[model samples]
Target: MRLLFSADGSSGDLIPMVLMAREFKQAGYDVCVCGSTEFEGMAVDFDVPYEAYPHSYSDIYLDNQKTGYIHNIRENIRHRERLFKGEFELLSKIAPDYDVLFNFLGEILVPSFAEAFNMANVKLFTFPVIPSERYGPPMGLPFVTENKWVNRLEWAAAVFSAKYLFSYNKTIDRMRGELGLAPSRNLLAENAQCDHMMIGLYEELVPPCPSWSSIDYSYIGPCIPSQPAELSDSLEQFLSQGSAPVYIGFGSMRHQNSDMLTRTLVEAARSAGVRTVLAQAGSTIGAEVEGSDDVYVLREYPIPHHKLFPRCLAAVHHGSWITTHLAARAGVPQLVLPQASDQYMWGEIIYKKELGPKWVDMNNLSQRKLRTALERLVAREAFTRHASEFAERVAGIDGAKNAVESFERVKSKLRR
Candidate 1:
């Protein structure tokens, strides 16, 4: 069987999809990945066929940092247009040979692709941000009550943003028209609208609520990749020297004030009497690393979290799915500085679980505040113990393998 893995977004999105693609390939199925050109190297690393989308999604991410959300949405639309111009053609080119298309998040164009190929599509995601009556809203709103109407309105706001505010409906209609598919008003809805199946990358990390029971979805935990070929000698040496340094890395989060943030992290770690190894995961903070007898910043490619995080006393990151879960799996307490998107929600999850500090707003973060939080986090024995127990629980689940098995079952049913 031939499979197409079409994942759109940054490294966080692309890497997991690539790992799942690797699983398919190892299962002796032919596989190809469709994603941003930024992830081409990752695809090559996994020895899979890759088809690049027109422009890098990094443009959208960097633009969001420079501009505001409204401007970011406009730029996203522009990028999507650029993407669809060539994306459809590429899908058409590959449609004949590939039997299935697996997607990450809600690609507005998935329905059109499914229509064109007459193939089954599976939707996989990490966060439970999809509009649901189960949770208040996607961005982790405070629950005022158990009133279902209140929950429904929260979800309505999300749908309104996609369909009206972001103007996704107009663009989606145009793309469907271009593909000769019927217009779709239900393109941006409050639930997983896929006809086939949807899967969550986490297994009850933020377990789905009762309201989401009707949705055709599965919770398959996370796909932890294999350890890197080897850590750099410098990074390895630093890990050996430090007294279980605090792990600081914001995976794929482009900070507007990298210098300030980097300095804050370094000083905060020192003030708390802990060393740090900052993983400059696609951040520009590498050049700002200095004056650090107690700190080492990694600007290199492939800082293996599985290996390095096990050596850290605590973790500080952007509350992305990969980093948060990895830290939990490593049994290290965390400090989450959330910027935007589902990150805010993930930070809250960490806080609620008592495994991390409260979500520190990026706009208002100061050295003093960070130092205090770190000091408190390190002083707490409960955080580390809870994190360790969570790690033990996570170790038993094989998420990537389960996802492939789920896909096989769905494909078999669809074929029949």
Candidate 2:
């Protein structure tokens, strides 16, 4: 069976695809991963056929020379355009060959493309719950609001962009014309004829799946595995010498004032009287701060939370879904500092599950706030016990295996 998997964004987005690809390869199926050039190395590492697509959101973000909020807004606009163009090109090239297309969440173009190709065996996978019309506030707004303003603005942007910027509506309409189907609202509803809808997040994290007659949606839990990355000897030594340092790191998101964040973390660790390993994901946290004796600011590290969390007293992180799952799996108490996106969701889940305290918004972060969270995480023995039990639950599930099995079933269904 030949399966095509496509995704974009950070390692968090690509890692799940890679894990599923490995499972399919092990099951004696030929799996090809189509994604950004950034994921080519990861595809190769997983022994899957790597097809480098020209579309990349990160490239657009980096290409814009501007910094701070303006940079982010410009990047978002560029990303929307690139996403439409890149997905169109990729679909035209690969839609003919694959028996089934498995798309990750945030893949805005797959449904229309699949309809264009008359590919009935397409599956849509999400790392989180599907958004309702009024679920969460719209992304990239000037300010968040509990009122209807944010959602209205979000819908307005979607309409304006679809009409003018990328002509996404035209593209979809054109595809629908080719398929002899009327134009529909959004890709998910339009692609209701798809064979499966697989959700990657666990039921615990997401609310119940939406009931759709044509789509088969199931909660498959998070796909996680240890990937190989190098760790500095000094960092390793620090971890080995002291009681496992509270693991603290923001994966890829850069802090505007990294020095301030680093200092605050250092002070909090000191106040809590614990060693700390700070995973500096590509961004520097300043030379003086990086040179600290008690705090190790590491550049690259292979220490997955599965391995490190067991040794640490507690963890403080940027509240990414991948990081939250890892921390929960390790059964160590967590203190999430949420910035944006699904970070807030995971942070709320951590507190709801009684695994940690409430999330600390990064914008409002301070030494005292972090210190307080740390103190609570360390002092509460009940949190640790609950965490350990949760860890065992995580260990028992084989997400990779399940993902592969699902792919194979879809492949078999397509053949029939």
Clash counts per candidate, in order, are 2, 0
Candidate with best lDDT = 1
Q: Which portions of model 2 miss their true places by more than 4 Å? A: 62-78, 120-126, 132-184, 187-193, 210-214, 227-232, 286-288, 291-293, 301-303, 409-416
After TM-score superposition, what is the CA distance of residue 223 in candidate 1 from its true location, in Å? Answer: 1.4
Q: Which regions of candidate 1 are displaced past 4 Å? A: 63-86, 136-150, 195-200
1-416: candidate 2 lDDT, tens digit per residue: 56778775667777787888788788887788777876588777778887777855456543442224445545554565566666666767787776667776566556665555656445444433233343332242223322345545554565555556645566656655665567766543343456676667655555552334346665577787766544457766787776777888877666676777778888888998877877776344533565455777666633455666666778888777778887877789898887655566567778878998877877677888888888888888888888988787666665677776665565445532
lDDT of 1 by residue, 343-406 (tens): 6677777888888767676656888888998897889999999888888877766667777887
For model 2, give the 10-residue run with minimal summed lDDT. Answer: 137-146
Candidate 1 local accuracy as lDDT? 0.71
Predicted structure 2, TM vs. truth = 0.83
Residue 161 displacement in candidate 1 (angstroms)? 3.1
Cα TM-score per model: 0.91, 0.83
Each prediction's whole-model lDDT (CA):
0.71, 0.66
